[model samples]
Target: MNSEVILTCAVTGAGDTVGKNPNVPVTPKQIADDCIAAAKAGASVAHIHVRDPATGGVSHDPAHFREVMDRVRDSGVDIVMNITAGGGGDWIPDPADPTRGGPGTDIQTPAERHHPVGELLPELCTLDCGSLNFGDMVYVNPADWLREHARLVQAAGVKPELECFDLGHVWFARQLQQEGLIDADPLYQLCLGIPWGAEADTETMLAMRNKLPASAQWAAFGIGRQQMPMVAQSVLLGGHARVGLEDNLYLRKGVLASNAQLVEHAASLIENLGARVMTPARTRDHLELRGAQTGGEA
Candidate 1:
């Protein structure tokens, strides 16, 4: 078992979860505050996604992202910020005309998806390696788009957390590394338990883990009720863990959990299994991440 682990808290995600859980942060202020609290509760990283405060819907607005980042940075917290570059890929086909997009469909060019990360210059940003049937819609991350996204993240001098939703994604991520699109020691996030993707189970996790490069650093997270189980499983398999409101909303069957509570609980599980969670400084050193930046500059 790995003795030291890095715990990442996905403070807010681009999901329809705001109405489901009152604790899900909607506004920029709430997201920033929750991220700060997660840091204090032993999370080394905070994965962020902005939302429309009024509608509680996903947003790719740079203004919202800037406010959240500014608040977190000004708060004197040392959490490693990881912004999502996997936005604007949702495609819901119109029932009447499959050729056209549905009302909720939001497809964007690689440039549009990379805008926030390119502008914010956070320590890390996600590079979703491949596309898959994401729930009811098709989350489109074509090979060309992924290559462009990887190049953008590389140019920004920000580490790309290659998010692999399936085994094929892991293979594509390795291909990106081989193409030299990703510069640093490649980091991967094995996203399991999502609908139409890899299931949240030991065999699936191990299968994906076995596909990683020898020098690659990786983490795993499961959605909903399997979140905690995947945490323990990932740690046992010599990988890092991620927990927060993004993937799981409840601490228990009927209990709605805050971001801090989720991080704290995950930390406890890590410690209980004879492992310790890494701090932000130690995580940065462990992953060889560059120092965080305020504005978007190389």
Candidate 2:
């Protein structure tokens, strides 16, 4: 088991959850505040995604990201910023015409998706290792695209949190490392419980975690009701943990939760499991992240 766990809270994911949960932060200011709240509640990192403030829909706007980053930095909080590069992959194919993109299709070049991360230059950012049938939509992160994305992220001097949704993704991650695309020490995020991808059960988490490079530092999270359970499972398996409104909304059955509540709950679970939660300083040291804020390798 991991003696010290780095807790990350993915605040305000690009999902249709604002209408369902009033506590979901929509605007840039709200999102930044949520990050601060997560930090105060014992989160070492904040995995962020911007939204169209007016519609609460997923937005790839660099302006929104800048505002959120500025607000968080200006707040005097010391949480590690982990921006999202997982946007522009939603592919809801047209029902009638298979060749045409449907109304919900939002695909973009690797450069377009990496624009915000390259511009903002956060310490850590998510680089989805591979594509999978995410629910009804095919979240396309093709191998070539992934290679290009990895190169771009490396050029920008950012550490990627390899989001592995399946065992194949873990395999592909190792290939990227073997090809010298990824940095010396890789970081993995075992994304679990998403539809048509890796399941939330213990067996799947173990299978994916076992596939990581021995030198890799990793964390795992499960969506919806399995969020807390995965926190325990991840720590027990010697990996870090993530929790927030991005993955799960409820604190308990029929009870809505804020991002801070989720972090606090996860922190409690980690402590109860005889593992101490790592602070922002310790997490940066552990991950060897780079950025102006961390003062390592800018």
Candidate 3:
């Protein structure tokens, strides 16, 4: 069991969850406030995704990101900022014309997807390792696109959290490392329990964990009801954990939870399991994220 664990809270994801849970932060102010609260509740990092305040839909607007960063930095909370670089990859085919994109499709080039990260320069940013059928939509992150994304993240001096949703993603991550596209001693996030991806069972987590590079640092999270279970499972298997409204909305069945509440609950579980949650300073040292104490740009 890993005694020193880094708990990351994915504050607001790009999902159709705002209407589902009232606690999901919509505006920049709300997202920044919850991130601060998550830090106070023992989260070492905050994984952020911006949304259109007017419509509560996912957005890649740099203005949204800038405002959120300004608020979080000005709040004086010492939390590692992890921005999502995995947006603009959603593709839903049209029923009438399968060759063209559907109404929900929002695909983007590597440059467009990397804009926020490149402009803002957060401590960490996500680089999804491969493509997979995410729910009913195809979440495309081809190997060539991934290489370009990795290079961009590397050039920005930010650590790329390789988000692997399946075993093949893990394999491709190793390939990226071999090709020297990834600069740091690779950091990974095992994203499990999403529809048609890896399962959220203990055996599956173990199988994926076993494939990680010997020197790599990794974390794991499950979606919906399996969130807390995977937190415990990840800790037991010597990996870090993630929790927030992004993956699971309810603190328990029938109880809608805020992002801070989820972090608190995950911290409690970590401590109860004979492990401890790492603070922001310790997490930065552990992950080797350079200049983390300096904070992000406004």
In the order shown, what is each candidate's alpha-carbon RMSD?
A: 3.4, 2.3, 2.7
lDDT of 1 by residue, 1-298 (tens): 7889999999889998998999999999999999999999999999999999999998999999999999999999978999999999999999999998999999999999999988989989999989999999999999998998888889999999999999999999999999999896899999999999999999999999999999989999999999999999999999999999999999999999999999999999999999999888888778777863333221
User: Please, what's the RMSD in Å of model 3?
Assistant: 2.7
Count the clashes in each prediction.
0, 0, 0
Model 3 residue 55 CA deviation (Å) reads: 0.3
Tens-place lDDT per residue, model 2, 39-144, is 9999999999989988999999999999999999999998999999999999998999978889989998999999999999999999998999999889999999
**Residue ranges of candidate 1 with Cα displaced over 4 Å:** 292-298
Cα lDDT of model 3 by residue, 95-194, tens digit: 9998888999999999999999999999899999999999998999988988988888888999999999999999999999999888868999999999
lDDT, candidate 3, at 136: 93
- Residue 228, candidate 3: Cα error in Å is 0.3
Spell out the clash pairs found in candidate 3.
none
Each model's TM-score, in the order given? 0.97, 0.97, 0.97
Q: What is the lDDT of candidate 2?
A: 0.93
Indicate the residue-level lDDT of 188 in model 3: 93
Per-residue lDDT for 106 in model 1?
96
